[model samples]
Target: MVVDIFIPCFIDQFYPETGFSMVKVLEKAGVTVRYNKNQTCCGQIAFNSGFWDHAKAMGEKFIRDFKDCSHVVAPSASCVGMVRNYYDEMFYNSALHNEYRTLKKNIYEITDFLVNILNVKDTGATFNHVVTWHSSCASLREYGLKDEPGILLRHVRGLKLVEMEDKETCCGFGGMFSVKNEPVSTAMAAHKVEMALKTGAEYIVSTDSSCLMHMQGYISKHNIPLKTIHIVDILASGWEL
Candidate 1:
């Protein structure tokens, strides 16, 4: 019932509220939450940018940061995917191999932990707005998280969930992929927003804030009529509404 939260760079710097919301949702489920101040990047950014050396350095630090924790949960599937899937390549034969393996088994995406680990179907939330889910590539493909998010959202009171055109499509915020290909990334975000609008959704929700940030940037820059929100934020909100 005890867990440690791993907040990635994106959420720590930009969407700290989402990180706090995740902790709130977990605590609401009657679980003990711990924040490791020593935690840092999961080396995903460096790994995706093709800097394995720099990534390995941070990966070591990340492993050491959460080495003592029983369970490590993150708000980001992208970062969890990094730790669960990619850490092996860097620590396979190294001294940190065993520790990284343990980290992989212990880490869970917030929603995944809620539905699977915590066996929680609802967090007593009441978001009375239209929402369409965006399946980040990491959330859907890498982490293979499909129903956990939907299962949790369906339980929120007065929340209307709609299906978008490309529910399984990428939001174009593939970490370094966005920076390396701005036009394509923007086009992808635009397409995603267009699809969400078609659903008449008041918010585009996803577990990954990176995608939200990308779409929100486009939504803001072009003055679009759409908004973006993280899944944890939705779950943490609406009780006071």
Candidate 2:
């Protein structure tokens, strides 16, 4: 199946390798992958920040950018959730309503697309490490993703998928929430890191790198004995670095 990947600003800016890994995993599963250079932000940041006008503008561009795509998959759940769930506020009953609806139905988060749509659980990935899954708030509540990521992780060779305390808890990286409430955000990240460390896990794996990025900052500042890795990176691991 041919799929277009929507690389969010978080992945495109910071964890670029993870984006490449996403492509590798999809290709390994025998799916055709395409990245549209014309694609930009999904207007989530603006939308979340209460800038409806700017958000709608960006959302319109995003919708038009992938208008012809059969299926649009994104590595970050938050980005996918923004489009699938939040775009309704700006586009519903509007001029772009029909187009927005089409995009919403066609877009999907990576794990959701892999396990549910593509029916792919194994991608020949081998990551010999004890890792815990961090179910980002958006992935769980907004995207309604529960067992999809776990299904894919279980098939990875040498990867022990341990459960983290409050895996469903928010990582406090609520986009603008992190910046607006620095102390609260930091404390939340600390709590999450402590939980992941308690599992004796070497890596805290998650679908949203924004969460990973937030936790990684705290982990690095305190020199915590843990690292953050995206599931795409883990799924693309196995045979190579």
Off by over 4 Å in 2: none
Estimated TM-score for each candidate: 0.98, 0.98
lDDT agreement with native, every candidate:
0.91, 0.92
Cα displacement (Å) at residue 15, model 1: 0.6
Task: List model 1 lDDT by residue over 1-241, tens digit each.
Answer: 7999999999999999998899889899999999988788988988998999999999999999999889999999989998889998899989998988888899999999899888999999999899999999999889989799999999999999999999888888888888889999989988999999999989999999998999999999999888999999989987676
User: What is the C-alpha local distance difference test score of candidate 2?
Assistant: 0.92
Candidate 2 lDDT by residue in tens digits, 186-210:
9999999999999999999999999
What's the lDDT for residue 192 in model 2?
95
